[model samples]
Target: MTTIEELLPDDLLETLRGRAAGYDEDNRFFTEDLEDLKAARYLTMLVPEEFGGHGLTLRQASQAQRRLAQAAPATALGINMHHVIMGMAYTLWRRGDHRLDWVFEDAVKGEIFAFGISEAGNDAVLFDSVSTATPSGDGGYTISGTKIFTSLSPVWTRLVVHARHEDQLVFGFLDRDADGIEIINDWDTLGMRASQSCTTKLHEVVMRPERVGTHTPLGPNPDPLVWGIFGAFELLLAAVYTGIGERAVNLAVEIVGKRRSHVKNAPYAHDPDIRWQIASAGILMDGVVLQLEKLTGDVDLVGTGEEPQYGGKWFLHFSGVKGRATEAAKEAVELAVRTTGGSQYFRRSELQRLYRDVVAGLYHPSDNESLHASYAKALLGPVRE
Candidate 1:
């Protein structure tokens, strides 16, 4: 069967670009744009075959994300949270009751599945999620705690919250309207404004055991190759940042061609210094993209199941790629700003949003300091410099 990536027609790509182009003017894209992704079945790429999904490999899925980001970074970010959350469902596929054909079919049919894993008072790492679930008379349990930065939560129908039970870290699907849950005010962030990564409160919510996945612990993901919990998150954020850089470079190329340099008596594109800076950024993204592509291939080959550190080298690859990509995208966009000057920063300008979006990646989970420490730990075998 043809994969969902193959099904993404050229028209959809162009429409995404148009939507992204609009973001600079007025951050118009929001959770609703995720509906576009659902309609396109972009969110169902990882559902297993028995669930009637395309079951794409990671590399193919990464390329799909790359293409979507290339069109509109804002829309890409919004839709992708749902996409990634659904994709991660594959990791939980083997643990739960696979017979719940609706979760699979509805997901493939474009249902928006948002993941909630980060908690405000917790360790801030994947394994550090401190939300808890306790036994109830029913086969399910009572889940209570506050989850923060639930990307795409503002509009999702169902949210998957991860919490620790006695021995197993469980995954529970909570309806947005479910009792005991409240979406606090909107997320006011320096970047990714359209992502809707808001804080959510869950007061003693009831959940069924059938709706939760068992054995996935509350702390560090048991996987070795992907750093278990943090790898996928880092990889996606890096790819997104890198994609924004790609857009900036392309914009710079288009702008320089038509605009004349006020000082040099020629187009700025002809200036040696500007040309070199642009080329340098382009080259860095080129290298980053190659690494991202390779990493995707590695992930596909490695699969999602837990293994060992040496067996998978998970922490090492994710940290390096994520750190490199975020930095590369940020530096490139900054340089593009230099290449374009004051004109690109205006409200009417395209580069304005590109610049904001690209820099946002810098603070994501794989930022320089956090990533460096992770890699250092991998090398020195503990959390060390």
Candidate 2:
């Protein structure tokens, strides 16, 4: 029998590698590529073996996310909106529907899932979301509210809704086709242009009590102090940041190395100021990779449901990885621009799109302001990670 891993050849993903860096210009759309990924069974890397999946480890999952990011941040962002959850949903669903044998198998076959967290009011962590779930007449609950920037909404069959039900935090799984739910095509984002992070709405949708399954086990729901916490998830973001930085630097170097040297009374790539920026970006990318490996290794060790020593520091580590990687990635892209000269900014060039898209990672959740507060909380020493 062919394994799920065997089904998703690196070549297929690699074929798309340049696309991530080339996204907006290429007119790429998940609705267009997603079927092919599903046909190849590329999304099942995380489903547990019992669920008939390749069940790749956290390291493997992180590496896959990086590869996809390298191809197209939007592709990775949309696909990984499901990819990150693939492996773990097995564990999560195991606690609920054992029949996920079919779903898990299908996921490896490229079915996807996405998070419905960012809404009209809650684009970032600090903002409050408008979505809510309330106790319906029966054991089940009704979910209603609008969410914006909900990526992969078009392709995903399920959405993991993080909601507040009567002042209590809970999550729920909602079907895209449910009677009361509607997905609106209105992301209109400046960067990550093809990600399709649109608006979604649910109007008093109902779910069977059992389907509630421990809280919206729809996508990547982090269960505090439990299996939901891991650097694999956070570091995946780091890997994307690193991948963007790496490509931006490489493309810049390629452009600079070929430029006229000493033709304009200047060394071009050899100029000290330009050289300094390239060198800085190189070091910054290296730092991203190092931090990624360290956090991945650490998280894999204690991903168990049990409490561990690193637990207290995990949140701080998240802040640092998210904070630093965002800065480093953006800096590298900026350097790529400085080194490539004005021609690189031509509206049609790949560099332009790469520069624009890479910037989106910087503003993703855990922006610098939130990262600082997270670090501050960590330093206080009395609270948890």
Candidate 3:
């Protein structure tokens, strides 16, 4: 029973942890991590068995992702975009939809995939796109616009982007070497620096029509693509933060058990208040982990045609999970810092980096405001627009 937890060997995980600090310090992409993951065939974890992949279910992948995050938060976060995209394709394929089979094909062929649909000021999310994709008069379209937060920008071989084409929102794939695609090296950020989530600029980039996977009217509809993206992204994002929280709890416990006091102490682990704080953080994290297990497990139900009974309810659930997990990560990190004393405040400390990285979970989609609104809608019916 080689479970997802064993996907990354202890030695590999240690190397990742050792390099994490240097990568963050230099604001560099996790190139070595990516290479190791590729060698392990992790990039194709979700691809079908016929495609020479592990064919792990979404649940297993989510578990593996959490474990990966424990070793390198930024690396896991960056790789998550790719995994979520693959998860989306898998979800569709499992339900007899072959529209995205090409994505899986590409994945099995060692081509890196990056999700580039997010845009600045287009909070409408999957419903709208600020970028434009006009007919190129050759059964293709010319996409022109800028996409921000394009993770894996420095290494991805292919990028998937969405843009408005007339009254429809269309999503297509672009090659990294595409003639008019430019990756702006402007991803210097306060946290998750190793992600290299740079801005991507499209200048009349031509994409073949076959590459256009989904096209829908510019608004909500009974489209599984939308649901898959929302589901996979939120769930996996939650998993990453949950991993960060787990690490924080472990670190807190280790520090409290090791730090000694000259006055009257064997170690602070025996101190009532220190134990209380660590216990509290552990309890919070326990709730998050249980929620993750449930959500990821139910994702299979979504792929098995049981989605209609739940309908839009899963979105609300996922929002709650993402919000709760991120906040719990922050809380756990804060408690870890407090228990570890002032030594964690220094830049060289791993706790210092975890503190910075955990806060970034706040910026992802289904943010606090949106999460509240969605929860309200789910509980109290739709509010007046």
**Top TM-score: which candidate number?**
3
Q: Rate residue 196 of model 3 by lDDT.
A: 96
The CA lDDT at 131 in model 1 is: 77
Candidate 2 runs further than 4 Å off: 1-14, 17-28, 87-106, 123-129, 215-233, 262-267, 303-308, 381-385
Please give the lDDT score at residue 13 for candidate 2: 62
TM-score of 2: 0.83
Give every collision pair in model 3. Answer: none
Worst 10 residues of 1 by lDDT: 222-231
Q: Which has the greatest lDDT?
A: 3
lDDT of 3 by residue, 203-297 (tens): 99988878877788886565777778878899999999999999999998998788997677579898889999999999999999999888888
| lDDT, candidate 2, 335-385, per-residue tens | 889888789778766677767777787666667876776677556744555
* lDDT, residue 41, model 3: 82
Per-residue lDDT value at 145 in model 3: 94
lDDT of each: 0.69, 0.65, 0.87
**TM-score pick, better of 1 and 3:** 3
Task: Give the winner by lDDT: 1 or 3.
Answer: 3
Candidate 1's residue-wise lDDT over 1-385, tens digit each?
5554565777877766666544444544354456666676667776666677777765676667767777777666766666565545543443342434456676765566676777765644555457778878677877888887777765777777777777666666776666898888767665677776778888888776677544465445654311423555666666677788887888888888778987788998898888999998899889999999887666655433542334435666777888898888888888888888788877667677777777767656655776676667666777435
